[model samples]
Target: MRLSPGARERLTIFWMLFPTFLVIVGFYIYPTLYNLELSFTDITLLKLRKGGDWVGLANYWEFLRSSSFFDIALNTVFWLTAVSVTCRMILGLLFALLLNASFLKRMKLSTLARLILLVPWATPPVVAVIAWRWMFDPTHGAINSWLLSTGLISDPIAFVSNLSTVWPAINTIIVWNTTPLVAISLLAALQTVPQELNEAASIDGATKFQEFRFITLPYLIPTLSVLTLMSVIWTFNNFVYVWLATGAGPGTFTNVLATEVYLKAFVDLRIGYSAAIGVTMAVVMALFGALYFRLFGVGDMQEKVG
Candidate 1:
């Protein structure tokens, strides 16, 4: 039998996408499925050669019953992810706006300014964390040295060792390392906005704030939406800043889910239980992405991008 034109087109598209589909399945879907399977078993490092016993939902139940589960979850969702994402979004937009302004172009300083802005991001995350650790050290750190000099405090304060200041310190490191990407992306988006719109708005006697609110902001909506999703997902899943900076503690006070997963699997040697936490975090992010796209309207975003 001969295929119809529409069927032929559909077949062609499917064949074109087949390689990409295989990659996604191989790298993402398969690993996620394997992790899910591992979550249900009583697997440990000792059971490497032999398959672990199937204990349906036991790991999940154990996670729910864990004493530190809520505290770690709260730290992951709010302190680590929320705080970093919020700060990144705000600072990224500000930097992008400043870089996008005509004053820099007129001053011939755009390239210089961008390169300087990239210094933090271009540095390795581990290096940035270590530098921050030194700065937060109690006795001889830069921050304490400055504060003492300014008479802000009579004594050097231990920023990292103190529970009250640890979260903020970690968040500062994350924001510094990540905000450059956000700013550059937003700057690219800002560049795509037609200058005609701004000029027209100005001719209408609109204030700078009104021009941005009316013309520029609509163009940025799609970019902002994507940045928001990326920020949440990346920050939530990130293990480096939290793990390297604090090692998940001054006695687990600043522990987040990613480090918890590592500590369980590697340190505590509870592979199955750690897989359960990984699976849970994955599910939560999936739901959040779905709800966010639903409320934000993926259709509208595509329309704007197009």
Candidate 2:
């Protein structure tokens, strides 16, 4: 049958998008639904071949009642807040500003600075973590040796093996690995700020701090908001640094939600419980994203992308 122009256009559009739609449904929607279903079951390694019976909210209840749950939650919060997101923002902005300086641009040092800054991010994560692990070793590590030689410490400090230092040690590694990407992103955003605005502010008797606070910072808010949200999500979900560096620590002192999920699934073989933990993480992130959008108004960050 012959179709009208609008009908033909609609059909063409649907056909164009059909493949992507199928891929999303198969890869994303199906797996999420299957995971939700598994979270309600008593699935384990032994029952891998044979399906387990549904246990309703038993898995969730078990996780909530688990002794380590509170500690894991607190560790996760600390990792996301103190270690990753906040540190990345503070350092990223500082480096971006320094790199964006007129003197750096005039001297052609900005390019070199950017390249050096990106080294940590460009290196493989596992390799970087391993190197950091060695550096944090109490004996024969450069850090400890340097501290001893400089009279900064009486003896070597066992960074990874001690509960008090383990989280900070691994977090330092995470910050080093992730901060470059944040700085590069912010640098691009900084470039978008009009020079005229800053000059105008300067001519109006504004101090450097006041000029940045009023002119530059206001322009960067949209970009910063989006980057902050993305950083939070990525940092919270990051399992590699924590898992590779200390394997969740000398004890459970540095164990966060991601590592706990990995341990529950692979090591303990509690598939259903792991699924519950994963679901909980997803729910928490979703709520955080919603609240972030409410506070930040979901500005047009796409335009700021370099």
Candidate 3:
């Protein structure tokens, strides 16, 4: 079959985008291949300055045996599950549902609410992290001062300083910042839902919970699944919160894969080992994303069939 004249014109338009394609290939693909090559070599700051030797998988094997690997892996898992699953997607969906309500729709107040909600998202993550770090400060911090004024506690809590609380504190800021995007995506989906369906259910004496359980939820599931998968990737890659908040300290509690990769490659000057860790993080995120899509697609298929 031959392309139509219209199709040929469209193809010409696409060809005009060749420069952008070349730019992506040059900057992204070329550097990615270079990084992969660098991973297999005994590349270092000193070596780069003086040329280096090939070291096979020695760097990878060393990373595998390193003590911090397991801890960082677990921390990444916690960050992904806690922030992406429980906070970002779940809370975003709830907030979206609330904002999608008919009352809110009529008043146009949802717009104001959404704008306010996006403040964290609009601001730079580094700025947000720094602001949050100060807010969580032990003494003279806003949170501590308020707690003391209200007699909520006798002492200022070491929110970010303590290893145990570090995970939650970092996650809180990430969730606060990222949830708005998720909420906005979900809100758009929710708005496309027909008002008549809910009205019909209500007239049929269906309770609020019943209407939401059957009508609203089924529609949101597909969108929610995609958002959740994306959130997992973003949260797993989150470095700013942990990096700026606790500096991957109280020894190891807050050291996620991204932060650990930076610490290893830049701080420890183990380029090859850090690349191995980077590859591991990429693999884990890819696997999780695949699983998420597969399971959600399966469920969606079953729903459609039934």
Index of the highest-TM-score prediction: 2
lDDT of candidate 3 at residue 152, scale 0 to 100: 97
Per-residue CA lDDT of candidate 2, range 151-184, in tens? 9999899998887788788878888988898888
TM-score of 3: 0.88
lDDT, candidate 3, equals 0.80
Instruction: Kindly indicate the candidate among 2 and 3 with the higher TM-score.
Output: 2
Instruction: For candidate 3, write residues 217-259 as lDDT tens digits.
Output: 8787777776766677777787877888888887777788888
The better-scoring model by lDDT among 2 and 3 is 2
Name model 3 segments beyond 4 Å from true.
1-21, 105-108, 298-306
- Give stretches of model 2 more than 4 Å off: 299-306
Rank list by lDDT: 1, 2, 3
Worst 10 residues of 1 by lDDT: 297-306
